[model samples]
Target: MIRTIDVHKSFNEQEVLKGVTTEFFPGKTNLIIGRSGAGKTVLLKILVGLVTPTTGDIFYGDVNFSQLNKKEMRAIRMKVGMLFQGSALFDSMSVEENIRFPLDMFTSMTWKEKAMQVDSCLERVSLGQVHKKYPSEISGGMQKRVGIARAIVLNPEYLFCDEPNSGLDPKTAIVIDELIRDITIDKNITTVINTHDMNSVMEIGDNIVLIHEGKLAWRGDKSQVLESTNDTLQQFIFASPFLQRLRAAALERSQEG
Candidate 1:
């Protein structure tokens, strides 16, 4: 599990995160949700060591991640996998090469060994026989799967996904969501996802954190979302007229029963 202790971040003179503390659990999909510029992105960056927190601590399985030296940080990073918002596959590289890139960069595995590992990851993502295909040759959804394949090739202990369902049809997005969720449980990885997708919240959100104005506004699972009376959560979640109506209907039905 990963835990943040009263973390705060400042950009020059402006503060972004303010004493935010939370825990991301293993074998579960932990989602960070907030409006744009609500500091969610900054929090994720801080958690992954991309940004330095101005105050407080980040702990990775009892290790003080915030205080780690460069070498120690690298060791922790090796066990962490990140799936970027755009899939971030190399356009010129084949699917196999893309998946094998991390192995080549980090490990002393032989070419044959790398190939086998790549193949295994591809199979795990339910993609078959696309080893030689370039990113442009496949659909957006396939590229996302390739990203997932690459992310897990190292069998990381922690996984981070940024907008995993972005830029895909609703159906394809759901497929990606389930794939991430399943992989997290199967590998028992501490999974943290930075997303704005409400579908993802209700579907795979085992732990949910809502940020508002640089502070943790609410915390709960998918089951509690609809019933939550927290004004901050309710305002952020039911911002749309359709969703407001849906929530009202859901609440009314629950009252009737």
Candidate 2:
């Protein structure tokens, strides 16, 4: 699990995160959702050590990560995996080489061992074959799967995803969401995702954190979203007319019950 204690971030005169505190548990898909500039972006950066918090600490398990020195942080980072918003696969590398990049850089595993590990990750992500394919040779959804394969290639203890479903069709988005959820549960890894995809929220949001104006506005699972009376959360999640109607029907059924 990862915990942030009274975390804060400031850029020049403007404060981004304001004394925020939260815990992201392992073996579940922990989601961070908020409007633009609500500080969710900054918080994700802080969690992954891209930006240090000005006032507080981040903990990985029992270790207070914010206090770690650069060398110590690098050691911890080897156990971390990140799935970028754009897939971030290199155009020049084949799928196997792309997945093997981390192992090559971080591990002294023999060539055959690295090949086996890369193939295992590719199989885990349900991408058999296409080893020789480049990023451009595959579709967008396939590229995202390749990203997932590469992210978990080293079997990281902590996983972070930024806007994972940004540019996919609804159907493909769900597939990707389910893939992440399954991997998290199977590995029992601490997985934190920053996403705007509502379908992901309703489907795999085992632990959801809603940030508003640099503070934790709300926290709960998918089931609580429909029944929640929190105005900020309701306005954000049920923004569309279709969703509002769905909420209304659920409320009506609740009253009848």
Candidate 3:
């Protein structure tokens, strides 16, 4: 699990995150949702140690990540896996090579061991046959799957995905969301995903954090989200006509049944 306590981040005079406090539980898909510039990305970066919060503490499991030394942080980072917004696969490398890159950089595993790891991850993501293909040769969704396979190759205890469903069709996006959620439960990984995708929220939001104007507006599960009375959350979520209708219908069906 990951927890942030009164976190604050700023750029020059502009504060991006304002005293944000939240806990992301393990074995679940923890979503951070907000509009652009709402500090969702900044929070994700701070959680992953890519950016330092100006004032606040972050805890990974029981350890206070904000207080860790550089070497200690590096060790924690090795336990982390990140799937970038764009899939971020190397254009030149084959899928196998891309998935094996982490082991090559971080482990002393032999070629055979690395290959075995790569094969396992690819199979897990259902991309085993595309191992020899380059990123350009596959569709966007396949590339995202390869990215996910690579992220999990090390079997990280903490997984972070930034806008993971970006650039994919709605159908493919839902598939990726379910895949991430399933892997999180199966591996019991502390998974954190940054996205504004309401579809993802309704589908796989085991834990949801709603950020508004750099502050944490609400936190709860999917069921609680629909029942939440927070004005900001309601406005943000029900702003879409489709989601509004869906929520209304769900409420009505529940009442009638």
Candidate 4:
């Protein structure tokens, strides 16, 4: 599991996060969601060591990540896996090379061992046949799958995904969401996702953190979202009239049931 203890961050006096505290359970999809400018991005970056918190602490299990030096942080990072918003695959590299990048960079394993590992990860993401294709040759959803395969190539203990469903059709998006959740459960990885996709929330959000203006406004699972009485959560989640109507209908059904 991963957790934050009253963590805060600021840049030139503009505070981005304000004493946010929460725990993200392992073997589940922990979602950080909010409207734009709500500070969810900052918090995700802070958790991944891309940004530093001005105050308080962050913990990956028992170790205090907040106090780690560069070297210490590097050691901890070896167990981390990140899937970028853009799928961040190298344009020039084949799918196999992209998935093998981490192993090649960090390990002294022979070529055969690296190939086997790459093949295993490809199969895990159901992209074993696309190993030789370039990112441009595959569909956007396939690219996302390749990114996921690369993220898990190291068998990371903590997986971070920033908008895994971005740029895909709704059906493809659901597939990606289900794939992420399945992998999280299978690997028992502490999975944290930075997303604003409500579909993703309803589908795979085992733990959802809603941030508002730099603070943690609410935290709950998908099942509690429709019934939640928290105003901040309600406003952010049901901003559209169509969704508001949907929520009302859902509530009515629940009452009848």
Candidate 5:
């Protein structure tokens, strides 16, 4: 699990995260949701050691990440996998090569062994047939799948996804969400996702953290979210016409039943 205690971050004179505290449990799809500028991205960066908080502690399992030295941080980073917002696949490399990048950088394994590992990761992401394809040759969803494959190739203990569903159709987005959740459970990885997509929230939000204006507004499971009395959360969630309609219909059905 990943836990942040009283985390605070500031840029110049402005504080972006205000004493945010939360835990991202293992084997679950832990979601950080908020509007733009809510500091969800900053928090994710802090968890992954991209940016350090001005104050507070970050724990990976029982180890305090905040106190790690450079070498220690490098070791911890080796155990981390990140799926970036844009899929972030290399345009110059084939799918297999992209998956092999981490193994090459981090391991002393032979070429044959690395090939085997790359193939296994591709199979896991259901992209085994596109080994020779470059990023431009694949569909957006397939590119995202390749990104996921590369992320998990090293068997990372923690996975971080930034807007995993961004720019995909609804069907594809749902598929990606399911894939991420299934992988998390199967690997028991501490998975943290920074996303504003409500569909993802309802689909795979085993643990949900709502950040509003840099502060933690609420934290709970998907079911608890539906029944929450937190006005700010409700307002943000129901602000979408589609979600508003969904809640209204759900309420009507509940009453009729």
Candidate 6:
């Protein structure tokens, strides 16, 4: 599990995160969601140790992550996995090579051992035969799966995903969502996702925190979203006419029952 205590960040003189505190539970999808420039991205960066918070503490289990030295941070990072927004696969590398990159860097495992681990992760992501293909040769959804396979190659205890469904069609997005959710539960990893996708919020958001203007405005699970009357959450969630109508219908049904 990951916990943040009064996390605050600033750039020069402009503050991005304002005393944000939250906890991301294990074996569930913990989502950081908000509008553009709402500081959610900065918070994610801080959580991943890419950026330092001006005044706050980040905890990975009982260890103070923000106070760790380079060597200590490296040790912790070995057990952490990240799925980038763009899939971030090397164009020149085949899927197998990409998945095996971490093992090659972090372990003394033999080539055969690495290959077996890579194949296992690929099969877990349901992309068994794409090992020889380059990133350019696969569909966008396939590329995302490849990224996921790479992220889990180390069997990480903490998984951080930044916009996992960024560019896929609605159907493909749902598939990716379910895949991530299933993996999180199966591995009992502490999964943190930074996303603005409403479908993702309503579908896989086991724990959702809404950041608005640099602070956490609300927190709840998917089941509580529609029934929530918080103005910030309502405004952000029901922004689209379609979603507003859907919420209306849901409320009407609830009233009848």
| TM-scores, each model vs. reference | 0.97, 0.97, 0.96, 0.97, 0.97, 0.98
lDDT of 5 by residue, 1-257 (tens): 89999999999999999999999998999999998999999999999999999999999988999999989999999999999999999889998899999999889999999999998888888776898989999999999999999999999999999999999999999989999999999999989999988888888999999999899999998988878989978998899888888998997998899
Query: Which of the two, 4 or 6, has more TM-score?
Result: 6
Measured by TM-score, the strongest candidate is 6
For 223-249, candidate 1 gives per-residue lDDT tens digits of 999989999998988899999999899
Check candidate 6 and list the clashing pairs.
none
> How high a TM-score does candidate 3 get?
0.96
Candidate 4 residue runs with Cα over 4 Å from true position: none
Cα error, candidate 3, residue 30 (Å):
0.6
TM-score of 4: 0.97
Clashing residue pairs in candidate 4, if any?
A: none
Pick out the ten consecutive residues of candidate 3 with the lowest summed lDDT. Answer: 122-131
lDDT for residue 158 in candidate 5, whole number 0-100: 97
The per-residue C-alpha lDDT of model 3 at residue 172 equals 92
What's the lDDT for candidate 3? 0.93
lDDT of 4 at 221: 97
Would you give me the overall lDDT of model 1? 0.94
Score each candidate by Cα lDDT.
0.94, 0.93, 0.93, 0.93, 0.92, 0.94
**Candidate 3: stretches off by over 4 Å:** none
Instruction: For residues 88-189, write the lDDT of model 2, one tens digit per residue.
Output: 998889988999999999999999999999889988888988899899899888988999999999899999999989989999999899999999999999
CA-only RMSD, every prediction: 1.1, 1.1, 1.2, 1.1, 1.1, 0.8
Candidate 6 segments exceeding 4 Å error = none
Residue lDDT tens for model 6, 29-77: 9999999999998998898899989999999999999999989998999
